[model samples]
Target: LRQEYLQHFQAWAKSLGLGHSVQPAYNLPLGMQADISLVEAPELESLGFNEDIDLYRQFTGPAHLTGRNVISTEIGARRIGAYALTVPALVGLLQDSYAVGVNTMVIS
Candidate 1:
């Protein structure tokens, strides 16, 4: 089902002239679950699985293994009451993502 979905998405992107520009981005937990369900045993449900950090590892692993040209992620700065994330904090988030093999980022 996942392959089918990817195929259809690729075709649709090609139709819209975005086949090369459209790269799949998977978030932690939910997106990880969807991707793992396609290829792995879904061991995330097992005890001792660290969903927080581990999901990032798991999600990035496949992109590297498959030799994806770009690995992108949606990043957000933590909100503090009335103010949004600080500039330094946002830079920290981008740096962390780069350390984890994310070459592209969609900031929120």
Candidate 2:
């Protein structure tokens, strides 16, 4: 059903000549929460940037698999407080996301 809606929306956008200009938001289930494994992983304590990289992979992997042109993430300073990351750590998160496959960041 999601794919069907995407296709229909794409066609509508194309008709309006806005297909290339607009990017869809591929939100993950659970309103942008990290996967449970990432939240609970013991190795996260020591993994540093690698952990961010891995989490970015998990975030964007599904969108890539589904042939999405623009992969996005809903992340912000407040949203990631549970991770106990510093400001530099948060920057690293965005960087890692781009390094993997996320082309768009939705901070909300």
lDDT of each: 0.50, 0.47
lDDT of 2: 0.47
| Model 1 error, position 24 (Å) | 5.9
Task: Report clash pairs, candidate 2.
Answer: none
Give the poorly placed runs of model 1, Cα more than 4 Å off.
15-17, 20-53, 77-83
TM-score of each: 0.59, 0.47
Model 1 C-alpha lDDT per residue in residues 26-76, reported as the tens digit of each score: 322345434533432122210122223455566666666655546655566
Most accurate candidate by lDDT: 1
